[model samples]
Target: MRILAISHLFPDLKEKRYGIFVARQLSEIHRLGAEISVIVPRVWCPGLLRHTERWKNYDHKCPLCRFEGIEAFSMPYLRLPGNFYNRWSGLAAFRAMKSKALELHKSRKFDVIYATDFFPDGDAAARLAKYLKLPAACLSIGVDVNITAHSSGIIYRHFIKTAKALDGTLACGQSVADRIKAVTGKSPLCVYGVLDLEEFSPAPDKIPARKELSLPPDKTIALYAGYLTKRKGVYELVEAIYRVQKKCQDLLLVMCGAGPEETALRRLIREKGMEHTVHMAGEIEPERMNKWMQASDLFVLASNTEGMPNVVMEAMACGLPVVATAVGGLPGAIGDCDGAILVQPENVDNLEKAIVKVINDNQLRADMRIAARKRAEEQFGVKRNAILILNYLRKIVEEKKAKQKG
Candidate 1:
């Protein structure tokens, strides 16, 4: 089956770690026997705060920028005068994508058009599909829904209309799916997140990895990897770490990722005298992330809201136990397996207790490690996930053809 995949969240050379999950999913779908083409909408601006001019220069030399086994195209966009007016910005993106998609449709016929996110791209894809008389599906990953509910007037109306128009919609987690259904009055397919098992595996030598990263050899390491945002509950995780450290002196916390909250987090750590206890590793490369996960004893995410976190899967793939708040699709992803210990969302006391439980009990930790690997191999493996997506695309294509004949 021929499929067109649209996503604006894909990673570039400068931001190699961004939206890697989307790239990985497309790669897996390709391996499953579907002919897939990717369209990544890239908005170019000079600075984060300033929008000067739009440039269309494509960077073809970066291997990391390219998705494997798929023909890819990029639609360069420029943010208009005011980004605060998201409706105007979104409309501009839609126009840019519509033009490129129409041009591509002239030469290549696709069975289905699949777009990611609920805004600009999904809306654009739906419009393009309507114009071309093709089925369109939107795969939402979280922020799209949040933005829609938070926005007003035209943007909210556009999001609702776009969701209603799509042939089918897929959500990363059940919570997201429920929200979509609530808004659109249509149930969305719930596709759990997956990870590359081969790329993320138990480290051959944990001690060596820890040494290479200069992590303390004796202390039990707890890791938090992702955007350090206020909503991510990083501050709560720090407090929990502090509580755990009081009981277990041989404890260390490593936080990896960069965001606006970094400065505030660092300040909190210093003010609370957790300088030696908690270490901020900043942003690390995706390839090197496995080393950090492997070196750690347990993976922890204190997020109050999430779709389906890819970091948790990566942690599980490394045979590390997870302690994450029960929120979004996290409970579904973690299951009730020995691999994970789920606590109530935003509860620092419960988080502290869970972390201490894993640290203190050697047998439990070992059991969790075994179970974590098994779960990763069985449920969240990239190969299995890719094949499922590919098969779904093929089925959709066949259905479309049958409809035409009838």
Candidate 2:
């Protein structure tokens, strides 16, 4: 089957970790024998006054730049002035896809179109599918629905409309799927993000790995790897870590990832006198993430909201126990695995208690570590998820063909 994949958040040469999960999924789908072409629409700044120092920092090889096997396109806009408008600008992507689709259609027939959520990408894909009379599917991955809904009123509504318009929709977790249904009255298939089991497997030399990362030698390391934002419950994590430190002085919290909230989180750590206990290692590469996960004793996610977190799966794949808030599809992702501990959302006391348990009980920690890796391999392995997505796409394509024939 021929497929057109559109995604705004896809990783580029500059930042390979950005929206990498989407790219990985597409690559896996390609490996499953689908002839896939990726379309990434980017903005081109034309005005001089609008181009500020800030614009200089924007990655040039972003969505516009071509990857190994994917087709990319860009459209000109009024630089800085266009920033605000460009976000909700479905027209830019629509025009790009329209031009590319025409070219692709002449030589190749596409069975389906798959689009990732957030920005105007999904709407553009839906529009293109409608124009070409092809089935379209939209995939939602956490922040696409949650952050967008809270940030942009116009885009949020468009997201709901786009969700309804698509032939099928897929979400990372049940909570996200339910949110889509609640907003658009359309149920989306829940497809949790996957982990590469082979790559994320537990490292034999944990002490060496920890030393390589420059982590604490004596303390029991609790790692949090992801965006350092307020909504991620970073503040609550600090508070929980502080509480844990009071009882267990030998405990350490290692936070990895960078965001606008870094300064604020750092301030909190200092104010709470957690300087000795909490270590902030900002924005490590995706390749190095697994090493940190394997080196750490437990992975903690104190997010207020989430879909199925990719990091949690990765940590589990590395044979590290997970202690995350029970929100979104987290409970489902962890299942009944003793390797993972779930606490109430935004509950600092509960989070601290769970962390303390993991730190104190050596036998339980060992069991959880083993269980976490096994569960990840069984459920969230990349190969397994790839097959599920391929089968789903094939079914949709067949149904569309049958409908046309009838």
Q: TM-score winner among the candidates? A: 1
Question: What is the clash count of model 1?
Answer: 0
lDDT of 1: 0.81
How many angstroms is residue 309 displaced in model 1 relative to the true structure, after the best TM-score fit?
A: 0.4
The pairs that clash in candidate 2 are: none
Candidate 1 per-residue lDDT over residues 292-366, each given as its tens digit: 999999999998887788999899999999999988777766767789999988899999999999999999999
Q: Per-residue lDDT for 83 in model 1?
A: 29
Model 1 per-residue lDDT at 310: 90
**TM-score of each candidate structure, all chains considered together:** 0.89, 0.88
> Which residue segments of model 1 deviate by more than 4 Å?
44-64, 78-90, 150-157, 181-187
lDDT of 2 by residue, 1-406 (tens): 7888887666666666777787777777777777777776555543462357446435444443344445544333222333246355665678756876878876778888888874567778778888888998888776677666556666666777777787787888777788888977767777866577888999886898888877766778899988887889998999898888888888888999987688988888888788888899988877788888878888999999886788988999999989999877787768578999999988999999999998889999999989998888788887788788778778888888898899
Q: How far is candidate 2 from the true structure (C-alpha RMSD, Å)?
A: 3.3
**TM match of model 1 to true structure:** 0.89
> Candidate 2's C-alpha lDDT?
0.78
Instruction: List RMSD in Å for every model shown.
Output: 3.5, 3.3
